[model samples]
Target: MHPRHLTVNRSRSSSTSAGSASSCGFCPQIVQGRAPLGQAVGRWSDRHRPGAVPEEGNPREHQTPSRLRSQRARPRATAGRCEQRRAPGAAEPEPDRRALRRTAARPPAEPPRRRGRRRPAGAAQLAPATHRAGAAQIPCRGARRGHRRVRHRHHGHSSGPRAYFCQNDHVTSSKTSIPRVAIYARQSVEEDQGIRQQLDDGRKHAADHGWTVVHEFSDNDTSGSKERGPKTDWARMLSAFDEDEFDTLIVTETSRLTRSLTDVLDVTPPRRAMRVIVIRQGIDTLVADFQLKLLVLVAENEVKLKAQRAARYAADRRKVGHPTSGKTPHGYRWVPAGQRDERGTRYVVDEAEAEDVRQIFREFLAGATLGQIARDLTSTGRLTRKGARWHSSTVRRVLMNPLYAALLPPAQPTGQHSMAAIDLEACTPGAWQPIVTRDDIVAARSRLVGVKPMHAGTARRWLLAGIALCGVCRKPVKSSRPVNHPTPRKDGSVAPAQRYHGYRCHFSRNGDVIDEFVSELCIQRLSQPDAVDLLTPPDDEFDLPALHTRRDALQAERKNVFALIGSDPSRLAAAQDRLEELEEQLREVDAVIAKAAERHPLADLMGVEDVRAWWESRTLARQRAIVQLLMTVVIKPVGMGHRPRRPQDVLASLEITPLI
Candidate 1:
């Protein structure tokens, strides 16, 4: 087939009249009775209409406005030009419909030589669009640029075949819109990248590009690689993107926005006309060489490998009882690398904080409740390192932590009870100086017997809430009754019962009367030599139930870790190392539990000169501790057949029995 060619123009001349098919103002191709080898017509005007003409001296591929208007005349195979070979008064030659169809697309004279693979025999080689007719108007993959429109000047010649990229155009004509952008900044806990620096660079980039900064968002010490914790700014930026609040998203680096390829896919939507510019990588999602998905994949791999290395390094640190890179634990401060080798830099006791920790343990072991300790500390203006007021939960957390006892938390501890689950006896002691002794921690742990730790904050003014039991239910009695009514009188007149705090039951007695009676009996007994054994706590040994619970938790957690990170060999290996460390910790705890010992509960009061004076001087918790330890008290029910209206009635309804 002969080479197909056409001359086209973008606009029509207003002067073309009827019966003027050969008007020079119309496109030369239309005036000559043919158009390019195309079938697609541009219905809507190209967004890049008007004079965006390239400079004449520019050597780039852009076509000049004047050059686009004129087309070089090509030799035609037909017998005559539309007008020159036709009669002056003759009607225009009727277009032969069969011939127009036969030459709609002319194949190359010779098969075009292609690299690598040979073109199949008899393939239709398309003539390049706009080779001489017009400039290339390539549509952007994700850019804000507009597509071009190729229209015929004459309405009468509108039926010619139109072509819409029977093939793609290699050259692009970018028409950039004024960018309104949102800047996003992120830094991980392990990273030292300054968020301010990222923001500053983003601002500078926007200035350089003549882009407007619509908003700025940042997350410091936040991990983009991990889908955990609050990445507040990151989430807000995504929401803004979805809302179309900004046309462009600018970040200092691709990884700062996301280390996950899925997130990368979500950020850029060509249909939404959204763009992402990564400053460090010089990547624009709208550019021809955008490659963000590949970059995202590389970033994800790097983060995964980095996580694995960090986990392994932490494991090594743990093996030697050294703390890893992270926030310093309370009561401890990091020793500088200048003071020791980089690897040897370790945690040392912070005297002020350590003293506070020791005091908390000291008071807790002395029968002071967690709330009382917290209140005392608060009253003394002693707050946490973060300057937050102490709560009972905070006090309990301090008490539960094995760090004070020179022990580390598990290799992989999850949830709030991480410290509560540590087994100091089973694990290798840390190199740092301990604020509290193992014996003190063991005692504190034993005292943490109940499920509801918040109960420690309740006021214990009534001494025998746990020590005293009810005769009917055999359950512990409490002084909770409010005597709102008077006692009964046979003559229908009322006589009020002595209104003092008492155990609420039909058979009742004053709490002060009962406490006085129990105290006298306890003091009298301890005053004797035979009660010597009762002066100190019993000799006993018990395994730590928390250690067992921690072991089971670690095993379940390891299985979960495997499930989450199993695909990556580096991360999987790191998790396996953590698992081994967990096992080592468990074995150590179990061995220690097997041979552990307990401390005496009454050791503080054992040497008091006067037992009654000592008891009076103690806090309610200590007094109740002594009462629960020495004897069992029951507010027994008395029948009508028993003594009534007698002074000994208090003794009849109350039962006090010695435990030792």
Candidate 2:
């Protein structure tokens, strides 16, 4: 604590002076001066100094400063003492001329001899304004710590400026002339290498430099590489620095300050002079060759390189149908290496959650809306894997994921396209077994997104535009208006300018009439007793005898390649990759031979009593799937003049062949 102002009365008594001095020992004896105290009671700096002014007649200014007798020992500090004597080489106080007016020569008390560096002879005898104001207004050279404000007053003296003194027990040299320091430590994530260790090191370094630790700031699990994320502590440290709270900063490393070049400039602000010590990097911001900007660039490059390596590793894992290191998917939990099954996959199915996943797929494929399914699941006692309420987006995303169907999304040179572009017929199998099959997921996903985009970017309007092929070119045809140019209708209104084409076999027909004819055929077929047989798979891929022969040839070939690579590292590496691919193909063939019939589509159509109304509700994509599954529409060529005049003509030009 520093003071207000100190004053002394103009009385001339030794007892009164000694009694007032006993309050605090900084100024050993109080002044009993005869001069009236001026309005400025405390003013001592390089401009104005405290010195003796002799009376008009007596020449007491010539008195020699007192020296301690050799017999007297220097005083020692006590338990509760706050005696702060001035430093070594400071000007001794002139004996009060008023005291000398009566007694010719009374020697003053000797100040304690403190051991410390002396002020140079050229140094100003007045206050330096370095340490805070001490006794009176003369600055003390004692340590500026462990201080408390104290006041000492003499009785019977009422008219003088009141003085406050900053009292501390131990008065040594200006030992507390140390710089104020603030430590800033940060770690981007929670880990063993944390801010605690950095702060410990910063405190130790500050102690070694004789700096007073003023502020300790830390940010844990908060990134410093980018000017993103919350760094409230870092901002506060800078604010305090700018406010002149402390002039020095300490850190465990250069990168801890910042990894971004733009943010690095803020650490060593050019406008304000400051000292920043990077402990581990051995770089000081005050040094001429600090190059903080260059260090930031290096740190930034290292961060980017590390990120790229992680992404490349994850991409490689995904290429082989393994998870790319993230939250466990809803159906499974990650198992450790040795505890996993022989195939070395990390996750095992968690049945309680898997049952929920299966339910979502079943209800969604059974023509349940996303919102209805989400509400029903949310009403149950069970919770999602993340312990969250089910939502329409959550259900839709689950349906879009290929993982449940035991297939990996196809990897493009960049990222793969959206789910609508996925080839459900040629899906790549994953290491895990299926919870929902390919047909079920594809059907459910199609209902959510509707029909895939048209090849020519036209909006989908007809039920079987893409599904029904051009019989001659084997190309899918789109709906087109009968007239290329706008023509007047029966009501004298011109037809719309935009036109579309429909499925053809070198001959065109009314698209609306063709759609109606196909819908009627589908309804009549589902009305038959043999509709269930329509779910059976084609026999082309069920030829087990040929598949077995191919499998034998592939195995023999792989064995010969294996024998040639024995004991050679480079060749063995190649052979392993080759064998793995062959094994994958073999597994596929085995799966195809045992593949079950897809009955989900028929299951959806099973219980609906009103067949026409149910058919009307289906999307064009699902309707097309059903029609392609049940039959093929073949259209044959007819001459140009073969334009249909009657509804019976379209029947003559069309062919509906049922494969089952």
Candidate 3:
């Protein structure tokens, strides 16, 4: 087939003379005289011929050159037709009608390469072949034609065409950064072995996951069952979490962290972004769906079960006439149950301590107050079971406990006990050896009841009502006065009036006289320029080196005990006993250190130039505190028929003992 040509006309006008028709590429001259117009004219002429004119002599003759070119461009009725060429710059000839028809009938080219794969040979062609005319090569119009092949290839596959999509850009392999982890370990009992094991397990888990262990937070002897109180290290670890110090937390198990569901939910829900890994439970909170909630519930149930079991064991032990709990009473010490069928231990009277208990009861029954008994015990260098100086409250507790009486009180009434009374007849002899007889106990109780004044009330206005002690009787001075008194009038007639009030020692000086004397003494002493130095003594120097050494030694001993705990079960009791002793000694050392570290508030007050103004500006409670810190005022009994007339005389009758 011959190449098809499309002639583009340079001239704007379509009309041309016979001479121009011979030169125009698009307007071809008819070789023979125009045949009949009907016979020469074909399909191409009917579709593309712009204008036609019939000749004057014949109907086949045409006057316009465009109509003549249109006739020559038609597809030949027979195959024997010759091809013609035209010169450049002539009127553009009509695109070869025969070439257009042949091009439309030819098949299109194949689709573009997809996903780096070659198209199959059997695939239907979709793109058009290229066509060229003169120097310019025209791309095939079939390529632009509406074909379903390209559209089907794009939308048919669910994965889409991989070649069109860059996997490196659109589809990514996730890069997971190693998470920083914090390991937390806790034990409810004072055993370092449990803590050590927890920490070891947690670290191993972290190592397996290739997580960076940033911190290890541990709490010893800290209970997880209760949500109250401070969990020192646990609190600190949470704070660290808030600061984004770690992305993951590793624990030996959930129970070590918290046994309360509320605490678990409260702590974990807000930190959903952080991962929690439990080594034993094989749970990761980050990926956990419902498992985390289930684990928390399990831990809470375990705590409840443990508590129930403990309560049952305690009740059973109490039924068997054994101490139901671990705490030893003040006069006794714990002993292993030697042939007793009780679960663990029994209480035996500590004889040396029991003697002290007997002395306390004897003194109380002999009319000594709780405070006086405490002072007496303290004077003899006796300490309580906790190894601290005795307090009046402590003495009172010992006196009140029914175990020390010949009989014990009925079991604490369940629900409510409105009718329960002190059953003196229920006294069981040899139930426990009594420290004091029933008569002595009754006498002491009767004296306590009798001493309770019918008009017992607080003294709000009296400055030293509760604090002032009678120097002679060694009892609290009561604020009192006569209800009525006679006031002398100018007419020499006496009228009733309220009497002046004062602090009274039951057997000695009047309350008014003593109050005035003490107040004036306190004001005068504090008004001195050197009063501050005299009132607040320098704190005693503490030997920190010795304290630190002692603390280190105790810590070393604790470690040694912890080491022996696993090897010797018999040694456990001894280790615990020694640890308690060491703990008390450590407390004493800590107290000394704390005292040295404290700065007295009086030190700040000392810098004031006007001491009286400073004292007056303070609250009454503060003023009383200052007075108590400085000295103790003792008012001596007045001599018979000797009344004081001067401040000096009054001062001489009183004793001021400086404390600082």
* Highest lDDT scorer: 1
Higher-lDDT candidate among 1 and 2? 1
Off by over 4 Å in 2: 1-258, 266-295, 311-316, 338-342, 410-429, 449-660
TM-score for all models, in order of appearance: 0.51, 0.36, 0.38
Q: Candidate 2, residues 448-538: lDDT per residue as tens digits?
A: 5554322212224566666677768877766565555666999999867765555554667557767788788888888777775654546
What is the model-wide C-alpha lDDT for candidate 1? 0.62
Candidates 1 and 3 compared by lDDT, better number: 1
> Largest TM-score belongs to which candidate?
1
Q: Going through the candidates in order, what is the number of backbone clashes in each? A: 6, 9, 6
Residue 249 lDDT (model 3):
82
Q: What clash pairs does model 2 have? A: 5-163, 478-501, 478-502, 479-500, 479-501, 479-502, 480-500, 480-501, 480-502
Residue range 389-439, candidate 3, lDDT tens digits = 987667655665545553544444434532123443233332344565544
Name the 10 consecutive residues with the lowest summed lDDT in model 1. Answer: 39-48
Runs of candidate 1 exceeding 4 Å displacement: 1-71, 74-178, 190-193, 207-210, 228-231, 269-273, 288-291, 341-345, 359-373, 413-426, 439-602, 605-660
